[model samples]
Target: MARVIALVIVLPVRLVWDALGYCLKQLWRWVLAPIGRALGWLIHHLIVIPLRFLWEWVFVPVGRALWWVIDLLVVTPLKWLWGWVLFPVLKALWWVVDLLVVTPLGWLWRYVLAPVGRAVGAALAWAWDVAGRISRAVGRALGWVLWNLIGRPLAWTYRVILTPVGHWLRTWVWAPVASVARAVRAAAREVRVALFGGPR
Candidate 1:
């Protein structure tokens, strides 16, 4: 009786549990798993594949074509223009400047300014020579005056006054001092000879 009662109670609960499990499995298999797989496939095909194709076929080629066009149209032309037109134009402008401005300036310097400068230099040289001659003449005159007035008087005073005074000092003062020094030296030598008994 107890086993029959337990079976009656547990059988309905187990059946309900199994029915719930079955419903979960059916929902996962039919709905959720299919939706997830479909979403993955759609993302791969629509977004990833198309983006890859476009990148490989469209974008890379388009970028390369743009680079080629830029090289052909812009870069090449600019290089050519710089090499052919602009460089030649600059060279011609420089030549024109040399011909028009520099050459004329050089000619002017050579013909007009140079001759004027030479003439001015010659005049300055002549003036310098004349000034030098005048300075020499003044110097000579001053020298002549100095010789007659100052030099001659100095010479005469040296000859008459200073020479006589020097001669008197030499004769009176120097001669007596020299005689006294010789006498003292002789006395010293005689005393030394007497004391030491050596030849005088």
Candidate 2:
């Protein structure tokens, strides 16, 4: 008797689900049928009719006429201008520029600058020889005094104090600075100097 009652309850639920599924299927078919017919009609009328008309009435004769006009007006004129006018004009200009600038520049660089450069180099060589002798004498005198008086002690002090300070200054204190910030700082300094009259 409990099995019979359970089967009765499940039968009604199954029937209700089947009815809902049928209604949804019928509604979808009804909605899509009209849209499919309309699309078929549009494909027949809009696409087929215009394509046939273009092929039969417009395309062939227009294409031939365009080809002929382009051959006459565009292609012929371009060929004539390139062959007769443009090439010769560009070549002539190139030749003129070669004569005026390039040839003279080559001669000047080769002959004129070569001799003048040799003369100036000889004078500089002589000056450097004289300066080298004088600098050697001065350096010897300074070296004698430093070795006798200040060399060892001063070197020791610098090694103790300045090496670490120089490293710290380079790595942490002084660095690559932005140009805009530098400019702003300089402007501020100038304004302060003008306002305060620069350290009395």
Candidate 3:
């Protein structure tokens, strides 16, 4: 009973809701969709197409003509002026400089400076060789003086005086002292053995 009552109650409401939804779908598909498409077509034809045509045909040609005029009037003349006038003037100035200044300087370098430089270099080399010889002779003389004054005398003293004194100390003083110490040690050992009654 409860199920039958619920079915009866819900059936009309469901049918009304589905009818409203179907009506809304049909309205969107027929009316709103066509209106939107018409508006899109109007915008494309009126605004977009005219702008594209103007950009392609009018504006591009005008810009290209302006650039060509600027190139012909300004840039070409400047390039010709630099190539024909300024370049030759600068080249002639360079030639004058080469004739007046560079040739004279070269002559001075070859004639005067070359011989002077060679003579100076030869003199310096000769002086350096003399200085080396003098330094070597002085070093040899110094070495000879040091050997005679200090080294030979010290060697003689070590060989003659020190060696004999060391030998005498070792033989006379060390040997006698060692002998006396041995005798005292032996006597002490004998006395200790007799007093303690131990076998030696």
Error in Å for residue 127 of model 1: 1.9
Ranking by TM-score: 3, 2, 1
lDDT of 2 at 29: 88
Candidate order (lDDT): 1, 3, 2
Highest-TM-score candidate? 3
Residue range 59-143, candidate 2, lDDT tens digits: 9889989999999999999999999999999999999999999999999989999889999999999999999999999999999
User: On residues 1-200, what C-alpha lDDT tens digit does candidate 1 reach at each position?
Assistant: 99999999999999999999999999999999999999999999999999999999999999999999999999999999999999999999999999999999999999999999999999999999999999999999999999999999999999999999999999999999999999999999899988998864
Q: Clash number for model 2?
A: 0
Query: Any runs in candidate 2 off by more than 4 Å, and if so which?
Result: 1-17, 28-31, 59-64, 118-133, 145-200
Worst 10 residues of 1 by lDDT: 191-200
Candidate number with greatest lDDT: 1
Instruction: Score residue 197 of candidate 3 by CA lDDT.
Output: 71
Number of backbone collisions per candidate: 0, 0, 0
The alpha-carbon deviation from the true structure for residue 51 of candidate 1, after best TM-score superposition, in angstroms, is 39
- List candidate 3 stretches off by more than 4 Å: 1-55, 172-200
Q: Report model 1's TM-score to 2 decimal places.
A: 0.51
Q: Residues 1-200, candidate 3: write the lDDT tens digits.
A: 99999999999999999999999999999999999999999999999999999999999999999999999999999999989999999999999999999999999999999999999999999999999999999999999999999999999999999999999999999999999999999999999988997784
